[model samples]
Target: MSMEHHPHDVFFRSFFSHPDTMQALLQLLRYKQMVWQKDDGPLTPILPILFYHGPDGRISERFSQLFHPETPEHLRPQQVEFQAILYNLSSVHKDRLTAEKNLEFQAALLSLKYARDNMDLMIDELYRLARTGGTVFLSSKRFALVKLYLLHASSLTYDEIEQKIHTRITDPVIREDIMPSTAQMLKQEGRQEGRQEGRLETVHETVVRMLAEDIALDVIARVTGMTIEQIEAIRQQNDQTDQNQS
Candidate 1:
């Protein structure tokens, strides 16, 4: 599948979709544009931040570094000069992420850093967060997003994931809220194993669930083993169903 359709791409894009993640860039451009258009007030300075979480380290921080290396030093001063605050999750220590006071932010960074290669560590941090952060962590929307990320990003089976969640979170209500039903898991496994036929309805339901979660079409296609065309059709049908019911 294309990188654009990849599960990790979807997961990260969804995880970072919150405004706070891109607030700096938004504010910077908005204020700068306002200052230019209105010419009534000084431009508010804003820091630019780039959050990166790839297997390799970031190559450069300064915008000017992207220029040709042979560019003369004398002319360098004319080039745009600015450094973004880089939060390279790959380089950040797990301890530092765990130390983050904001439980939601900590979970996001940890998931980004370790979800692929370090599932054990990721689960451990999540367990820790759930245990320590208590009702607040369990109730937040981030918890659901994190759970969804793990479902797609990790190689662990659905039962294994549920077991881990069960082991970590002792509250029955929270566990019930977090875990998918056995029927759902079986349907997911059958879909993954390419069992169609009578399962079309099941598959459509799964697609609808993922779509409701704001998962990308390509990502849903990958997960459900459906074509983008099919998923789009289901989405349209779903929209019509909602419209007619309303």
Candidate 2:
């Protein structure tokens, strides 16, 4: 489920090709079937989701679609025992994606669409989504997850990702909690290198402290892996912010 999306050539079947994986999935299906029979109806079916964002590859909902079509009729019917709903994210255009009402789903589509190509565009898209969707959407757990995905998936460092949202995302929940909380989570996962702290304080405060220290933008960028633009923007935001007086 957590992948850059390339190896998933045939959805879960790609990774779950191992006999054990199918067996496990089948076991889950069996349990669900039992639950359905007892509590509800077998009409309820589980559909697996594949969120693919790779640059180049043919994508299709059915695993059978990947196979050559000129085969005999009987050989085709069983090519795939199951299929997943593929979110072919890379191919989706921003304009076409605008119709999506769920900001969370829209974020996934946009983030994956730009994971390899444009960090700035992705950042702008997130900002636009937040601005239009309101604070409730901005502060949702989905937004936080999308933010985390953008931070890790793109070349943009944590600080750079922070810069894109910290000042612009006026919600205290997102700025003060979700942002640093994600950083903390990444540190715990050992995904963030050089994350050391005697007492875990907010990364927002650290950025403010660095700005106040008159640290050069390039130096801050190097230390935090933030771009020079991000550092400068942070300086501008901090200068205008009342947090300095507090």
Candidate 3:
């Protein structure tokens, strides 16, 4: 696909992109909490717990496409096709077993209510995921994203949640691999000097160069919120750079 119309070009196009979907994700997270509370607040290892929420294909496809892009060019489109299944799996209880059967739903509204009803199981599940090694934290999105937020967002020891789910991230490589803005650019933002127009132009060029080398889009997206189209536009802006490099 051309960069101009690359199918999964937008970040907000993410399955968890919508506010309602985000809320549903949060609700599902509650299951992890309830699981712990029932134990009177201490978590111990149990089963190789696997938390699967919504099964929407769009999300699953995005996760596949965005995560394992080098699989094969022709098969890349398959990633986009499963987005709905991803969302469906990431939210609501379907085939998966939860402590409360009554909290099951076929749609988002019902799922939210169901989750609220069974919040205790969700908490226990979270605590279980945090304390175990083989625990599978498979959501349409990264388990760490929510887990980290919960650490400070709640009074509960979210760190225990990290431990059980095996989410104690030691990704020093992530910090190193990501590009840093220039000293001057960093200084302005730090000092409340605000954005300077020229800085944006320079940053754009830097991001474009990074993208052409087939850098992971997740990394690129973190560095620049520019749509994939915008990043590709940088490639077009500097044809000489494109021709001269990867």
Candidate 4:
């Protein structure tokens, strides 16, 4: 398979691998490259972004490769061992960790939001953990709360998102950092509104062209996600506008 397909294959593997035995070391390679660039200290407990179908979850051999490593495969085995240390702490008490360590795990958990759809369990755990007043890396950043919504929002597609990694922000902390800029938020909102307006214009223009050609109103409605009544109304408006232009 192509390199593009490799990461997805690894995702599938993660879905099937043992929850505890799956190589945590491999994940660190990816985390270090992407999320954990700042810290290189001892291992800590972190909730990884687990991906799968439905709530029942699953186990597979593919789990070892879920993380894409920065270094060559030769160095990854050692990194994986380091990562295993974090996974082993999955059972540790969240309250027992230092403020910094708590934030590290929470940020990791937030990152996992992109890997799965429903994050009810993860969110609940975050709230539960935050009650201890532990620090999360994201907490230091602006718009961290908004980042949680984007991360945990069930409406977006993880598969489509993973593919758009180069163009989009996949790291929760990074997104949070950028999203807080008033200029950035306004620009994004404006772009979204523009897209919606463009779509509506396309629908209206298509209906007008079809009406001129004497196509059925129902056909225009079906193609444009509009109602038949709306199409007829547009047709009337078009006729008047055409008359004025003449």
Candidate 5:
């Protein structure tokens, strides 16, 4: 969980609260039991970790700490509680980001720390990691992943980052590996957007037909799975269009 801000504890709790998710995960764990067993008896523990880098000043690491203090302590027993380690990256200094002897881990954290304002630093560190094969911060083959990220996150152009990579990396095999990334990204994005637009258009047309039939907003909302407010807004928009045509 690479977060931009500290998340509410319920955010994590809600995930584990789902019985299907827990069951699936536990079943998977049982299938891959670390210890040899005649038959899988009990499921193992699940430790969910959150890597946060949000704008919040304070958020509790423990599950119980997220609750309001004004609530009665006795009532707290009924509430769901679970431990999740939150690594608030914004609060962590680069110098102190040891990352447990993994150079890749360290490099990733360092880049994340300076990603917003200092993209140059992030790119430079990534280049260093690629050169040494010392970090998985940005693998030599996957340069395009971060390139896409920077295009959205920073002012730097694709040409500029590609040139930077070309300057550092001369191997043809690696270059070939990175080339298709942007095209693949575009293809996936185009398909996803096309699907979404089609879906929205279908919904709008359905809403328009239902409005023409003089359906109540509440009934439309229930049948179409849209809020009453949304149905009303669509209704109003349709009315305005009719007035204009007239």
Candidate 6:
């Protein structure tokens, strides 16, 4: 696909293009390098951090724990005994995550924690956070990025996402700022392709395109004026065609 049509490429380009974002990223890299330097010079004090948000709990904390069970106990002292500070979002309470002082961090953590299982609740929590003084730390652009992240990570349709944002977030300025991103998302979903063709796209073609974009079946049915069963039939046919081609 073209770079212009790729959602990830577009998001990264727009995100990193900002001077503040670029500088913050560079500073983070510099700090990491400084803390974990492995040059000929004396070693820097290293404090590793593992930010984990998977469904499973963390299995190990120290490097030594990875050693073979058959290894001699006497050799234990010779092994590197490195330990990392683990920030396991899966194990953290929602209230604790919400209480985080950094607005960006709180939003990010909540998003990661719930993106797989409960994206709707995550959106509601984000809206609540914004309502309660979180907007001070988030620019419209940053909040838009957060919304884009939701779109990327969640299974919700674009219309559903728009509805959630519209219903939950009442700030007119913030809503206005997010309009451009909404357009970008629509373009990424191939919404503009139909317009550019100078003719209305057929139901079959529209369904195929929406399926490729991973839009929810109900949403596609609503847009295309078809039932969920009809959409599912199209999806199955498309899948069968792909298998035969392969």
Compute the lDDT for candidate 6.
0.55
TM-score of every candidate relative to the true structure: 0.52, 0.48, 0.24, 0.25, 0.44, 0.50
lDDT assessment of candidate 3: 0.35
| Poorly placed runs, candidate 2 (over 4 Å) | 1-51, 64-80, 83-85, 159-185, 188-246
- The sequence of per-residue lDDT tens digits that candidate 4 reaches over residues 76-174 is 775433222222223334443333354544534343332255344444444444444434433543223233333323454433433343234444644
**TM-score: which is higher, 2 or 3?**
2
Q: Per-residue lDDT of 64-107 in model 6, one digit per residue for the tens?
A: 66678688989977976655455566788999998888676677
Once fitted onto the true fold, the runs of candidate 1 whose alpha carbons sit more than 4 angstroms away are: 1-39, 71-78, 155-175, 181-246
Best by lDDT: 1
The pairs that clash in candidate 4 are 13-62, 13-63, 16-59, 16-60, 17-59, 17-60, 25-80, 49-112, 103-135, 103-136
Clashing pairs in 6: none
Considering summed lDDT, which 10 consecutive residues are worst modelled in model 2? 10-19
Ten-residue region with minimum lDDT total, candidate 4: 1-10
> Model 3 misses residue 88 by how many Å?
20
Residue-pair clashes per prediction, in order, are: 0, 0, 53, 10, 3, 0
lDDT by residue for model 3 over 1-246, one digit each (tens)? 012222322111112222223332332233324334445434632211122332233322222434454677787665422232232334544335344332211122222222323334444454433334222432212342232222222333433433422332334332221112112333332222465666676567546554443333333444455675666566456654544674
For TM-score, candidate 3 versus 6, the one ahead is: 6
Each model's lDDT comes to 0.60, 0.54, 0.35, 0.39, 0.48, 0.55
> What is the C-alpha lDDT profile of model 2 across 67-127, one tens digit per residue?
6778789898667455666555566667977678888778766765785568777766776
| Better TM-score candidate (5, 6) | 6
Cα error, candidate 1, residue 178 (Å): 2.3
Tens-place lDDT per residue, model 5, 1-246, is 111222221122111111123322332232223222322544334444545533445554455555577879789987646555555667777668744456555554554455556766665665555555632433432343344334444455556756655665566555545445654643433323345554666566655764553333433454345786787688668756765786
Per-residue lDDT for 42-90 in model 1, tens only?
A: 4334344556654573345565666688999899888765555666677
Candidate 4 Cα misplacement greater than 4 A, ranges: 1-100, 113-115, 134-139, 142-149, 152-191, 195-246
Cand. 1 Cα-lDDT = 0.60
Off by over 4 Å in 6: 1-41, 65-80, 133-142, 167-246
